[model samples]
Target: MTKDEVRAKWAVAKRMVEITEDEYASHNVEAQAIKFVKTKLQIAIYYLSQLDEHGSSYTMPFTGKQMKEALKTPITKQNVKDAADWCHQCRLIRDKACATWNYEEAKTA
Candidate 1:
């Protein structure tokens, strides 16, 4: 997603988080449903973070030949292990976006 789109999704997720928290606090039932929704929202947030605004996925830190080889290989545990650093970078970017949004909201509040 674009930066703007990411920010918008983060805002929506924040609102949904608040709503789900309130729902859990106010009701005596359906806790599982609320938790499930929150989980899905979080997954969406992270998945989107791995894509650029143009919707192309970010690549791992590899040479062109390595990237091609990796693509040809089936996804395995080793692939995820190798991509940990890239994943961490993406998570940091996502967190920064969310933090900037929260800071802006805090200023207004």
Candidate 2:
């Protein structure tokens, strides 16, 4: 996902969590949950930014024909499918396209 895409998702998540300045100031359990979610979002942002810096043309993390062939043990197709699903959910790869986060917009936001 691009940086803007990530930010858009973050905004959605933030709203879903209903983070408010007053709640943040209180720093209670709800605040902690928000912090945890924010941290995860930040990590995703960082990973996406790094991916962009490395270039979008790079190969996917795993699941190339060579990678599949290299496995000695019998690998279930589901394993690869699961990994791909997780990657997509994490925004590591979107629509099989390698994209990095746009840090400039993220920073400004």
Candidate 3:
């Protein structure tokens, strides 16, 4: 379902005394999707700020503290950490999926 639909369901669920299984699932999915989107956005901003040096794994490039400071909303440190962790997990998953080495040109990498 679309994010807006999920959000509308969640809002209605919040007003109910007892939520159904489907409502619970919708709320859960919405929460996870929100976090995933936020993490991706933060990842993009964090990496873009690094210019070309971000490719080097030797350095952290930017820390969670820096990200928090860079944010305008004054979010908590835990939120920043969680987003960074989620972004790192996404990166690792992509790398693992590409580990089959099925590419036609390996040297180009």
Candidate 4:
């Protein structure tokens, strides 16, 4: 997705966080989790915003040999499916967390 698309999605997530925070008591476990997530999202948003303002250029930590070896690895259909499954699982977990926290916006997320 484009940066604009990502930003739009982030806006929705931010709003959901705000709503969740307002609904739950601060001492509640779900509220605490949301608070933690909000902090993490804020950090990520800040980092990405900085990257947008500046250039996204950065040096890779991997050595040339390590990079070459990684590149040489053939990505199979199963590998791709596994990667997608992992991402889906992560989203499912997030959705479940949101649902457990009683965040209505979780449905749309």
Candidate 5:
């Protein structure tokens, strides 16, 4: 995805809070905090993922519970893995569009 798309996703993800007064407010705060860190995380990973032509082994910081809370996905190990994997894919695509093709044009070959 483009940087703007990633940013928009992050914003939308942030606003998708399912918290209520009757529900666990502490859980809500913790989940939101995790989301904040994850957002910061995507920006960093996106910058670095571009450094590689393919991708990198970027581990997500959030635990299974946190990942489930933020993504609203199943609490499987692969689900958490896919979250990071998807970010890496976006990063590689974003970087290659700018870095790889332009460098090839400038190459001696």
Candidate 6:
């Protein structure tokens, strides 16, 4: 996913929750959702980092993988894929091109 796409998705998601620039400044409900998305993306990126550290060919049990391991329930590839897709849908990550965080564009009015 590209960065721009992620930002776009975030914009849409924020709108869906009726979050505006003013609310974000005040740290209101919409801001909370933004925070959730940011945290989720951060965790996903950390998971990707762990995968990189472990090497691409290495396949640990889903239960052993740091990201999956942290989950209370079993984490499947489909689960990660779904979350990743959600991030893309929320414009949190780009589905194509480069991945980036469009904080300025997404947060600004």
For residue 44, what is the lDDT in candidate 5?
37
TM-score of 1: 0.33
Q: What is the model-wide C-alpha lDDT for candidate 1?
A: 0.45
Candidate 2: tens digits of C-alpha lDDT, residues 1-109:
5656555644543343343577478666545544444444444434544455434544435333433242223434544444344345546453234324355733443
Model 1 per-residue lDDT tens digits across residues 37-62: 44434444454443444344444333
Ten-residue stretch with the least lDDT total in model 1: 64-73
Top candidate when judged by TM-score against the true structure: 4
Instruction: Give the distance in Å from residue 56's predicted Cα in candidate 3 to where it truly belongs.
Output: 25
Regions more than 4 Å wrong, model 2? 1-20, 57-109
**Clash statistics: count for each candidate:** 2, 1, 0, 0, 0, 11
What's model 6's TM-score?
0.31
Report lDDT per candidate.
Answer: 0.45, 0.44, 0.42, 0.40, 0.46, 0.39
Clash pairs (backbone) in predicted model 3? none
TM-score of each: 0.33, 0.34, 0.31, 0.36, 0.35, 0.31
Lowest summed-lDDT stretch of 10 residues in model 4? 64-73
User: What lDDT tens digits, residue by residue, belong to model 3 across residues 2-82?
Assistant: 434434534432232132355345556444444444545445433332222223232333455544443324345555565
Candidate 4 lDDT, 53-84, residue by residue in tens: 23343332223343223222253344334333
Per-residue lDDT, model 1, residue 43, is 49
Clashing pairs in 1: 1-53, 2-53
What would the TM-score be for candidate 5 when compared with the true structure? 0.35
Candidate 3 lDDT for residue 88: 74
lDDT of 2 at 13: 34
